[model samples]
Target: MPTKVKPPPAVTFAHPSEAEIARLLDFYGVRWEYEPRQFPLEWAEDGRPTKHFTPDFYLPDFDLYIEITTLKSSLANRKNRKLRRLRELYPDIQIKLLNARDVEALFTKYGRRGEEMNATKAEK
Candidate 1:
């Protein structure tokens, strides 16, 4: 009988833009991982995590985390609050928040608009 081999875990992107960013990172030879770790921003009295924050990308080479948010005003406000809390709790961890405008700027630089960016295959 042949030994069964387990397949490697598939990398899933929560949004189309994440896939676009992955392509760019691959092109630049900048190794990156998607949501490699989640930091607990709030804990309950039982020591369980009540609130957590996860950055979109983690660049091993840069030793930093990049959070991409394309949410509207209200959602962005909430995201910003979480980021602030994450920073406060984990001061040593380096992370950056890339808002929609920043991502748009990047798209413009690559001559790939938002529509084209969404053309890339993404999970969820």
Candidate 2:
């Protein structure tokens, strides 16, 4: 009897930029996880987490978390604050934030248009 093969699970990215990043990582043979962990940034009076920040990719080989943001300036500023708070709370945690311009450059280098960076959200 032949054994049944299970298909790999599908990954859904919050933004097109994330998918591009995944492709780049795959091209380089780097192992990565998408939104694997969330770090609590704020706690309420009752001790529950009020806010959390989840990075886009976690590279196990490099022990690093990367966040790619192509949002507008206002939204990017919020992300910056969250990153700052996360670093303050977890100084040992390694993280890198790729801003809009950085992401654009990456896309350009890889032959992807800047507009495609955030063209749509939640793409499979």
Candidate 3:
């Protein structure tokens, strides 16, 4: 069966949660461009048809690609395959995977609104 692929959203890096990671970048005066919108398939030598992979963040300045996965989706074969393909295609490209707990912890530790907000929401 032929699967359909959706176009990447018109999202920018500014949307990343203003937690420790982001704050740390800011504190260190590091600048990065996120989701520049180049097709992953372009990196493939054979030009075979493959599912498009949209990672969480693309740090152009550092030449790194980040993929953040939750607990459920992290374990999926699809994720593993994508990781493998990325590794095969671009061995030098840095790939980062973050779990949900890390994200929440980031939110709790350095979230602009503070972890108390998260706690209140979780209670509900």
Candidate 4:
């Protein structure tokens, strides 16, 4: 009998920025889960979840969730509101929101300006 080798899991990232962040985490050997959990922000009268907030990445080692937004400040308001609601509902959870400027700075620090530009273009 021959042994079989399993292929690596395939993950589809919603944005290029998320892929970049995953690469960074892999490079540093930090374990991460992409969009692994969704927290309910709003519920219907019947107890059904009407709105949810799913953070982009979860660093299990650090027990932290990260949400990345490359949108303009004005466009990010909805996400901001969702984050606030998530924080209020789940005060024990640790989550961080990285805005456009923060992500740009990260890309610049990692010499990935081209990828950052691509992400910006995709956002628009």
Candidate 5:
């Protein structure tokens, strides 16, 4: 029987192929919390429970929350509703969203840049 090999941890978003928006946060030195689960407690006009939404990362340093979406469909309406509700629930909190393409582009560009910088240093 062959032993399975797990891939090494990646420093580049490209390695995981998810575009890794975390790199952007790291680049900006923003402290972040990932996969935070939040339940809705507010009620509708008729006093029905609100919907639950989970944002991707929470930046404590910036006092902002972020969501990264890779779905093909534009979930703008759903995202907006969640943000609005979240604001009403937590007045001081801010939410930021980044789409898949945006994150992927950043990863490709920055990952290449990092590689190039390393090669240059190696040559020197």
Candidate 6:
């Protein structure tokens, strides 16, 4: 008798930055999924869902969720707030946010410039 194993699902990216991250992860031999699951962060007083969040990537090998933000815009701030609430609600979930500076550092560590990945989408 043999056990059944499921194949990895195809990863899709809604933004160019996310595609770049997938490439970087692949280069490092790390498997990653894009917005694989949504986490509920808030519920209404009547038990209705008020808010939910889906992180950018899930690195199963490391058991971590990676959220990338190339800008300091209000949307990013909102996402940050959601992440905070998510953390408070699910303290056991492993997650990290990779802001512009962190992304630059990651590229530099691999002898690549963050700017090389199209400054149009990257942070200034």
The candidate that achieves the highest lDDT relative to the unseen native structure:
4
Q: Can you list the residue pairs that collide in candidate 6?
A: none
Between prediction 1 and prediction 6, which has the larger TM-score? 1
Provide the lowest-lDDT 10-residue window in model 4.
Answer: 112-121
Listing every candidate in turn, what is its Cα RMSD in Å to the true structure after a full C-alpha superposition?
Answer: 5.5, 5.8, 11.7, 6.4, 8.0, 7.0
**Candidate 3 to truth, TM:** 0.53
Candidate models: Cα lDDT each? 0.83, 0.84, 0.60, 0.85, 0.64, 0.81
Best by TM-score: 4
9-56, model 4: which lDDT tens digit per residue? 999999887887887676557899999999998899999999999999
Q: Which segments of model 4 are wrong by more than 4 Å?
A: 1-7, 112-124
Ranking by lDDT: 4, 2, 1, 6, 5, 3
lDDT of 4 at 112: 57
* Pairs clashing within candidate 3: none
Residue 89 lDDT (model 1): 92
Better of 1 and 5 by TM-score: 1
Q: Which stretches of candidate 6 lie over 4 Å from their true place?
A: 1-11, 113-124
lDDT of 2: 0.84
True lDDT of residue 67, candidate 5? 75
Positional deviation of 110 in candidate 3, in angstroms? 2.7
* Clash count list over all predictions: 0, 0, 0, 0, 0, 0
For candidate 2, give the lDDT of residue 106: 72
Model 5 stretches with alpha carbons more than 4 Å out: 1-19, 37-50, 108-124
| Residue 19, model 2, lDDT | 79
Of candidate 1, the 10-residue stretch with the lowest lDDT total is: 115-124
Q: Compare candidates 1 and 6 on lDDT and give the better one.
A: 1
Query: Which tens-of-lDDT digit does each residue in 39-89 have in candidate 1?
Result: 999999999999999899999998999998885888788989999999899
Over the stretch 1-124, how does candidate 3's per-residue lDDT look in tens digits?
9999996455434334534354445444566445544437433557765556766666777878766665776465566677788778778778776666777775567553434554555686
Per-candidate TM-score against the hidden true structure: 0.80, 0.80, 0.53, 0.81, 0.55, 0.76
